[model samples]
Target: MTVYATFDSPLGELLLVGEESATAVGGTALVSLSLPGQKGAAEVRDGWRLAPEEFEEITAQLRAYFAGELTCFSIEFARGAGTDFQRRVWRAVEEIPYGRTATYGQIAERVGSAGAGVRAVGTAIGRNPLLVVRPCHRVIGADGALRGYAGGLPSKERLLGLEGALVP
Candidate 1:
C-alpha cells in the first residue's frame, strides 16, 4: 500500500511519498520527496493512506538537516523506483558530498556517459523523483551556474546556500 505525508520545511511544504519497508528507518521506503510547486509533484491520490506517524523519523532527520545538525540521510528508498539508466544517474547524484557540487558533464562521465550525454544526464536529473534526500540539487552546470531544479532555481540557491556550497 502507498502512504504519504506532508512536511513544512524552510523551503516550503513538501510532499513525501513512501511505502512500507522492513529495512527502512521508519518501516517505510521513500518513493519521492517533492517540494511545493515542483514539476511533476506527487499528489494525494485515491487509495493512498495518509500516515503522518509513519514519517516521524524522516521529519526528524529533515529538521536536523535544515538545522545543519545532520549532513547525510539514512532513509531508504523503495526498491525499483526508476529505470536502470535513471537509477544510475541517481546513484551518481547520491555520491555528491554534502556542501559540494558537481557538473552535469561530471555526473555523465561518472555514469560512463560520453560528453555528448551531458544533456541526457541533465534530463535524468530533472526527472529524479526523490529531491533533497537524493541530493539532486547539488548538480550544477559546468560553468558553475545553478541549473534547473525540480523545486525551482530559487529553492536550489537556498539549498546550496544552506549547505554552504554557494560561492560568495
Candidate 2:
C-alpha cells in the first residue's frame, strides 16, 4: 500500500506520497487538485508524518529548490508503470531545465513519434504526479506565453521567477 505525509509549503499544503524504499511523490498546493466527480474535497493538515528517509531527502531538495541554489534534483523514485508514449513524454519533461522552457510542439518533436501531437503530450504532462520536482512548469505555450500548468500559473510564475527566468 502507498503511505503518505502532508506538509505546508510556500505554495500551500502538500502531499508527500511514498513507497517502501524512497519518497516517490511530492504534490504541493493540493487544494485545487481535487479530482472532479470525486467523493469529497481533499484536505491537508500541518506536520503530517512521512518515512524518515523520505521526509529527510525530499524536503531538503524542496527547500533547496525554493532557495534557488539548486537547479536539478536527484531523488530515488519509482516511475511506476505507464504506457510507452507516456514514458517518452515524461522523459522529455525531465529534459527541461531550471530557467528554460519548451513548447508542447517541441516536446512532441523530441519524443519522435509521428502524429502524437501536442495534446497527447499535454495529457502525459497532466498525469505527472511528481509536480515541482519534475519541473513541468518549464513547459510553455508556442509564443512564449505562460500556458496551463498542473500546479497552476501563479505557482508556475513563482517557480520561474525563483529560477531567474521570469521576464519583467
Candidate 3:
C-alpha cells in the first residue's frame, strides 16, 4: 500500500508519495516529490494513507536541505514512471552536485547519447517526478541561463539561489 504526506519547505508545499517497505526495516521508499502547484494532490487514495509522521525523516532532511546544512538526500526512493532513457537522464541529473549546474548537452553526453540528444535529455528532465530531490533545477541552458522547471522558472531560479549556485 502507498502513503503520502505534505510538508512545507522554503520552496513551498511539497507532496511526498511512497509505500512502506517490508525489507528496509521501518522505512518507506519515496515514489514522487511534487512541488507546490504540481499534481499528486493531497487526497486519501484507496490504498494510500495520509501519514505525515511516517515521513519525519524525509521532512527533517528537507528542512536541513533548505537551511543549507544537508547536501545529500539519503531517503530511499522507489522508481517512478519513466522510460529507460529517461531514467538514465534522471540518474545523470542526480550526479549534479549541490550548488552546481549542468547543461542539457552535458547531461545528454553523460547519458551516452549523440549531440542531437540535448532536446531528448531536456524532455526526460521535464518529466522527472522527484523534482528537487533529483536536482532537475540544476540543469540550465547551454548559455548559462535558467530554463524550464516543473515548478516554473521563477521557482527554479529561487532554488538555485538558495543553493548558492545563483546570487540572490
Candidate 4:
C-alpha cells in the first residue's frame, strides 16, 4: 500500500509518500513529497495509509538536515517510474554534493549531452517527485540566478541557503 506522513520543518509542513506494497521494479520507493498547501497535501485516497513509523529515519535525517546538523543522507531511495532520460537526469542530480550548486546545462552535460538537452533536463528536474530528498533545488540557472522550483522559488532559495550553496 501507498503510505504517507507529514513532517514539520523550518521550510514548512511536508508530506512524504511511499509505496510499501510496490510490486514494480523497485520494491519500495518514495513516490512524492508535497509541501504545505501543495496539490497532494490533502490527498486521502484509498490504498493510502498514514504510517509515520515507516519514515522514522528519513524524518530524523530531514530534521537534522534542516537543523544544519547533517550534510549527507544515507536513505535508500527506490527508483520509481520515469523514462530512461529522466532517470539519468535524476541520478545526475543525486551526484551533486551538499553545499554545492550546478546549472541545468551542467546537469545536461553530465548526463552525456552538453548543450542539447538543457530544457529537457529542466523538465525532468521540474517533474522530480522526491523533492528535497533528491536535491532538485541545487540546480540553478546558467547565470547563477535562482530559477523555478516546484516548491516555489523562495523555498528553493532557503534550501540553497541552508545547504550553504547560495552566495550572497
TM-score of 3: 0.91
Write the residue-wise lDDT of candidate 3 on 1-168 in tens digits: 788998888778798888888654247888888888754334446878888877888888889998889988887877656899999999999999999999999999999985999999999999888888899999999889887787888789888988899632
Q: Which lDDT value does model 2 have at 129? A: 65
Listed in order, each prediction's TM-score against the native is: 0.97, 0.78, 0.91, 0.89
Candidate 2 off by > 4 Å:
22-53, 114-116
Model 3 C-alpha lDDT versus the unseen true structure? 0.84
Task: Give the winner by TM-score.
Answer: 1
Local accuracy of candidate 1 as per-residue lDDT tens digits, 14-72: 99999988888878889989999999898999999999888999999999999999999
The Cα local distance difference test for each model comes to 0.92, 0.67, 0.84, 0.82
Q: TM-score order of candidates, best first?
A: 1, 3, 4, 2
**Model 2: lDDT to the true structure:** 0.67
Model number with the top lDDT: 1
Candidate 3 residue pairs that clash: none
